[model samples]
Target: MAKSFASQGDLTEKKITFDEVGPDLWAFTAEGDPNSGVIIGDDSVMVVEAQATPRLAEKVIERVRSVTDKPISHVVLTHYHAVRVLGASAYGADQIIMSDAARGMVAERGQEDWDSEFQRFPRLFEGYESIPGLTWPTTTFTDRMTVYLGKRRVDIMHLGRAHTAGDAVVHVPDGGVMFTGDIVEDHSACYCGDGYFGDWGTTLDAIAAYDVDAIAPGRGGALIGRDAVTRAIASTRDFVDSTYAPAARVAARGGSLKEAWDAVRAECDPKFRDYAIYEHCLPFNVARAYDEARGIAHPRIWTAARDLEMWDALQG
Candidate 1:
């Protein structure tokens, strides 16, 4: 039997976990779902990666309120994916920050992504109706920007392109912790539908250089030690390399997309078949890797219609 298109069959809700990874730093994670990070400064707070919708974002707010009453003053978007940015409104943060490249992506394909993702995975958009619209960052920096929450210093930097063209990492120097968005995942699969395949490994290298004590990744559990952090980064690199290598081999041989798909499945399945969102992300990852190997530097925008067409062609 054919698999469900994207995450349509993933209807069961996941249990959420709120854990402290560093000094006054928290990770709001659900089983394989998009995760958010909380940074409580001396005065207010900063949130990383808003959930898919306001209703889901409210859950993060509930977790935030559990530990600190400090107001959430800033919402930092690591990239421009709808699941990550659409909930920015829920925070009512005075400043919504993103990299300039990320903002450009928001303008280029934000609505298309929202449509495609909503059609692909219904569970994440629990309160889709409440989404105001495409989320726009109030402030955008080309490379790096630092925000102060009273005495605490949080450095947000566009280290390199991995998950998306404008991926950002939030580093807290005092605690040696980093909120690495989708750039580094723990047990979950990396969604490379909009990723930069050739640049991903280098980006991971830059992140590894930080030597962060802990990391709140894009999904799965938080990394609380240097060992866990190192392992997660290496595994993420392996996932990316594994996905791209076989797909690229097929593309280089002038093979069909289906051939590329089969190649990727053969290489990735044994290792990542049980990983979260593995099925949901496989087709897209293969497509992008194939494209990149064939000389397509930029990822194609995925509209709702395009999603269905690709799924049918690859998995039908």
Candidate 2:
């Protein structure tokens, strides 16, 4: 390859920020790295989105300790991505939750994703060896399930598929706060390698309907107010639209992947070049968009070898 995969070259560590997005909701964000959410209820705490590895999860645990002494009773995984779910064991929660579709994807392509992600972004999996094995949810729900953390009502729902086939969002009704997984991102490029462009916006629309006061997004900073939350949702939608349109256009005329790449860059570069992981996400996003445009409904599983092949073809 002419250059290292974009994330492979990203060695600089990001500054971590722990912000309170609601009455007892906290977001642990590290620049554009994967983000985790904390929901402190009346009795125990619930953590959303585990980091890539056990060691990385420890970082989130440290921050959670700073505020509340309640034990983490549950861990919620928003999706099946290795970067988001592999750190499950570290939490030691009594219950782990995911949408039913997420567990299906795990059975389908979990190991392939793990290998692909570990090669693509080494920095995020700082303690890869510490990860015991694939993380599995002890419990799962089909559409929506409500759990009461004491009197605090937490709703976990599969609004629709955006970033992945099984995308779950957590809503804390008391504080009007929502912990949207990758279905919503703030100032970060949506990694659409395994995404559904056709379904993403619809999912975003479902989230906007709630009009929640605050949001703990999948990445970047926490959206603390209605304005910030609205802006993030709009920006994320724009990014998805901008990425898909040009690639779909290229596909419509039976153009090469390289042509689709150029077209997407021309459209997205000026607007999203400064976004976190923009380069890392662009090639895969374009490839998937092209495939989707050509009528491929489901995304192809990405393996380590496939990652190198795609990078070499697109960036070499």
Candidate 3:
């Protein structure tokens, strides 16, 4: 039987875990689903990566309310994926902050991405109708920006591109915690539909340079302690390297996309097939890898129609 598309087969509800990574930082992780980071300050709170919909984000809000009643004054978009954003309105934050590159992506393909991702991950967008519109960032920075929430420093830096052209990391220097959005997944597979495979390792290197005691990744659970954080970074690097290697080799040999994809599956599946979104991401990941192998510097935008066409081309 043919496999279900994207996360359509993943309908079972996962038990959500709200982990305290630092003094006032919380990571809302639901199994291998998209994760959100919460930083509670003395006067206000900042959230990184809004869930797919308003109803979905309410769970995060509920978790936030449990510990501190501080208003969510800021919401950060690590990237422009719909699942990681769309819920900004629900937070009622005074400002939605994102890297300028991310802001450009929002302007470029936010609508198509919203449609594409919503179709891809149905479970993640349970209350899709609740989303008001494209979540636009009110505040945008060039390379790096820092916010002060009652003396707490949260550095939002665009280290380099791994996941997208506009990927950013939330660093809490004082707490030794970093919220890495999809740049470094724990057990979950990396979604390379809009990824930069060639520069992903370099990006990982920059993130690893931080003195992180804990890491709240894009998916899976929070990596608590330095050892787990290190392992997550290493594992993420290994995963990226391993997945792109076969495809790159095949492309260098002037092989077809199918050949490259087959090799990628043969090599990556044994190790990453069981990981979260492994199957759903593999086709897109292979496509990007193949493009990168052929020396494509920037990633092409993924549209809803293109999603089905690519899926059929790969899986059929």
Most accurate candidate by lDDT: 2
Instruction: Using lDDT as the measure, name the better of candidate 1 and candidate 2.
Output: 2
Most accurate candidate by TM-score = 2
| lDDT against the true structure, each candidate | 0.93, 0.94, 0.90
Off by over 4 Å in 1: 1-3
| Tens-digit lDDT string for candidate 1 (1-316) | 5556759889999999999998899999998999999999998999999989998999999999999999999999999998998988999899999999999999999999999999889899998999999999999999999999999999999999999999999999998999999999988999998999899999999999989899999998999999999999999999999999999899988998899999999999999898899999998999899989999999999999888788878965
Number of clashing pairs, model 2? Answer: 0
Better of 1 and 3 by TM-score: 1
lDDT tens readout by residue for model 3, 261-310: 89998888888878888877888899999989898878888888988787
Which model is ahead, 2 or 3, in terms of lDDT?
Answer: 2
Model 1 earns a TM-score of 0.98
Candidate 2 Cα outliers beyond 4 Å, as residue runs: none
- TM-scores, all models, native as reference: 0.98, 0.99, 0.97
**Ranking of all predicted structures according to lDDT, beginning with the best and ending with the worst:** 2, 1, 3
Q: What tens-digit string does per-residue lDDT give for candidate 2 at 1-316?
A: 2687889999999999999988989999999999999999998999999999999999999999999999999999998999999999999999999999999999999999999999888999998999999999999999999999999999999999899999999999999999999888888999999999999999999999999999998988999889999999999999999999999999999998889999999999999999999999998999899989999999999999998788778864
